[model samples]
Target: MQAVYSLPTDVSLASHGLGGFDELPSVDVIVPSFNEDPRTLSECLASIAGQEYGGRLQVYLVDDGSENREALRLVHEAFARDPRFNILLLPQNVGKRKAQIAAIRRSAGDMVLNVDSDTILASDVIRKLVPKMQDAAVGAAMGQLTARNRNDSWLTRLIDMEYWLACNEERAAQARFGAVMCCCGPCVMYRR
Candidate 1:
């Protein structure tokens, strides 16, 4: 495979013997799963696969020794149809942080976006986040992460409200001062 080089900003593509980037950015998303809910996992992958960014994007499903081997197989088979989807299965169950580090280590893009198996993303999520990486001091960029629980159960509703508030208010405020402490694994895009 040929090495992919970053486009030079000073020179236009026509003058550099190239055409255009076609909206594609060099970004990679890593999702770590441990006995993840198949329905939710599928939704997460679907959202990623539906990304509108023309840049090369890949979703890495890091399976941390899921006990349900059959479900794992099914998920692997589902994503195997596309070149952009990849599965990295570990022999034993590892904690989320370890799995996250492993995913980061295996990633090959200029930036790495870490997300959970249950989270879904908008098509333009990466497009908006990737641009933030241009700043050297900005180690990471995170966005609103509202939960999509349709259930009317009290606990579920309460959790949704808390999550919504965190994403909308707290996170938004932290973003302004660049004091965002937590990475919020759901929709965080990080510079590699």
Candidate 2:
């Protein structure tokens, strides 16, 4: 695979003046949606908007033929309010992978963050994740995922446990040796 960002191995983390790094590269966030709940999508966008990274950031929302007009309206409103937000509306339903690939092809950032429409990010997510990419050999990274509806149902609770074990435990072990096998689609970052 081609490397997405060219990070300097000798770069100092504290030289950027942000108490972390200086001259941080831009990051483009890609979100793919198909008839997603407007409230959820709004929360996702709000979370991204709250990021504290001191660098250029852009958001690309790929609508995969969502039939929900209300959801579309919400998306359009966000695009209008945020100068950094862009939208690509498909005429027909396409798979998530296709939507993401299309958006990634159009992104111009040194790093690309793929987040699901239903996922909410912490305010410091970009700040935390960007540093991981400083390692020249690292190409991709992912954040932990907790169930949003864990208290709503037994199934959700069970899935939450599964996420902890599968993502936190199993993947953490694999990532230690620089050999992370797979990345969860809910929230992941990739170079280029």
Candidate 3:
């Protein structure tokens, strides 16, 4: 899979006085979505596109046969316009786990970042997690998840609280275990 932005032109991405080059780990972010709300998806993508890391990053949009053509169009359109983005549309609705595996197969990076379609990443998310992959046994590194739409409704607020509490407890356990069975569906990063 080739990025729309290739060589030379892309290579000239140097900042005037950025003190030359520093080694940075590459990352691929895989996001699975099925007919997600457009506004939410936009926010999610925007957050990723806004990451502050200087590493080579790629985004995989695994389309699990979204029923809404318009929503799918928006995602594909973004992919078409952005070299860092890739769109993999499944012919039929497959499970989320399957979609993730497919994205992994297609990813071309030193590490992987798995996120929910409706979730957004913090600007420093990648910079914070990618460095941890340098440790040989560190298979994965997860980041904090803060709800972005908790005020949308009472139900959303409740879910936000539950998610927050669950994440808090899980993070503490993760610190002890140094491993997580399944990283949080949103805001988690992994090494290849």
Candidate 4:
């Protein structure tokens, strides 16, 4: 993926307390949705709203032409109270990649967090991920992901195991070489 802006390499972690999170930069979260289940989307939004990051943060929810009116209404109602939440409703159905690109173009943050509509993040996710971007050479950082419905079925449990292996083992090996090939789409942070 291409980065939209240059990252600073001179940031120091010593001044700020633990992880230098007090120096967190502005962040914009881009969420792309196309016919997503309303309940799942609500949970995802709630998770984002509950983030404890002290830095400036905004959410851009892109609706890629969802046919379900109820889903659209749910999104509007759930996020209506927050001024930081912005909704972009495309006139026609667009693919996820295109939707994300559109949001990225409009984003005004120092870093962008691209999250899937179905994923729910931990409250400190951004706090943990932002520190990785302090290294100018690192263009992106990704968070660990497990099936949100892992207990719903045996298949989901198997998928959760796969996710663990991918995030813990494979990605860890790649990080040692500074050559991670793919960032998990469920939750990822990028410089600009």
Candidate 5:
């Protein structure tokens, strides 16, 4: 529960952030989904497509043998026109990790971001996150997350707070020592 304030990270924050990174690395976002709601999946993909990063970006949506055939077909057709979004269909029900690994093998991005299929990214998520990876010492970086359905109930609100504290406190404190222990599945960026 305690967030350390004394430890200073090796890197200092830069203004505009565009100048912080020596080079804008190509990013590959891998979204792994099973039988996720069709609407939610669309939203997630849309958010990634809307990112403001001024670098090459690719999205690989791995369908881990979803049972809803019609929904999958609709999503495939929906994003068919965009060259950035590639839908990878699996023959059978492989696990989420396997699905992600499969996409990683086929990608040629300088940085890899793992985003959950149900998570909607902020517009500037990729633009802001990639700078942190400029530090050679950094292993991975995780962004702050709050449940989109946080206002539904008290429990949801509590879960949202947990997400905040985990990122702002625990993860932030750990970053000072270059030992942050999260590449949280919801949103994380690391050099490939």
Candidate 6:
């Protein structure tokens, strides 16, 4: 069987410089959605817009044949004016992979960030992630998840623990050698 390779990008004790990279690569963020909650989607897009990375960042918001296209209008209205955010509306609903492909085929960002519609990122996420991908041998990188409601309930606490183990222990160990077991889909980065 094929196992996925995923690990967190180590930004701990990060230096102010670009980790020896001559120039930071441009990044394209592909977000696929199908009738996603407008609130969550808005938050996700807002996070991307708020990235502190100093490179060119383009966001592709793809509507993957949502039964209610209007659900996306709220988000569209929020980000439509931002030149970096492009909305792609598909007439029919394809799977997530296909929706991502639509943007992949057209985007020219040296790095591609495949983020789920509901995922929200920290302001420094892309800034920290880019330096790791600057290494020539590195093909992809995964970011850790932070549960905004980790203390809200037992389930949230359990999930938070799982994320810590999966990202910090398991994935971090494997990532030392450019090997990861499985990347979390919500916020994985790739080199194009």
**For model 1, what is the C-alpha lDDT against the true structure?**
0.71
Clashing pairs in 6: 4-181
TM-score of 3: 0.80
Residues 1-192, candidate 1: write the lDDT tens digits: 011111112223234232233344578888888887777778788878887665688878889888975766877898979999888888999888888888888779877888778787776676666666655778887756655653556766676666666766787798798787676667788776
Each model's TM-score?
Answer: 0.80, 0.86, 0.80, 0.86, 0.87, 0.86
lDDT of 2 at 131: 77
* Clash tally, candidates in order: 3, 3, 0, 0, 0, 1
Cα lDDT listed for each candidate: 0.71, 0.77, 0.71, 0.78, 0.78, 0.80
The alpha-carbon lDDT assigned to residue 142 of candidate 3 equals 67
Task: RMSD for all candidates, in order, please.
Answer: 8.5, 6.5, 8.2, 6.3, 5.7, 4.7
Better of 3 and 6 by lDDT: 6
How many clashes does the backbone of model 6 have?
A: 1
RMSD of 2: 6.5
- 1-192 per-residue lDDT for model 5 (tens digits): 111111122332344455356667799999888888888888888888988778899999999998985776887778766999888999887899999999999899989999888888877788777767776877787676778777777877787788778878888798788777775678887788
TM-score of 6: 0.86
Cα error of candidate 2 at position 83, Å: 0.8
Candidate 5 is scored at a TM of 0.87
Over 4 Å off, model 2 = 1-22
lDDT of 3 by residue, 112-136 (tens): 9888887766676777676555567
The deviation in Å at residue 63 for candidate 2 is: 0.6
Candidate 6 lDDT, tens digit per residue, 1-192? 111112334583157376556667789999998888788788889888988877899999999989877877877877989999999999999899999999999899989999988777877788888877766877777787766667778887787777778777988798787678677778888988
Top candidate (TM-score): 5
Instruction: For residues 1-192, write the lDDT of model 4, one tens digit per residue.
Output: 110111122222343353533456899999998888787788788888988788899999998998985656867666967988988889888899999998998889988999888888877787777877877788888887777666777877787877778778999899899798988787889987
lDDT of 2 by residue, 1-192 (tens): 000111122223354344234568799999898888777777788888888778899999988999995656866686658988888888888899999998999999988999888888877777767877876788887777777776677887887777777677888898798688987777788987
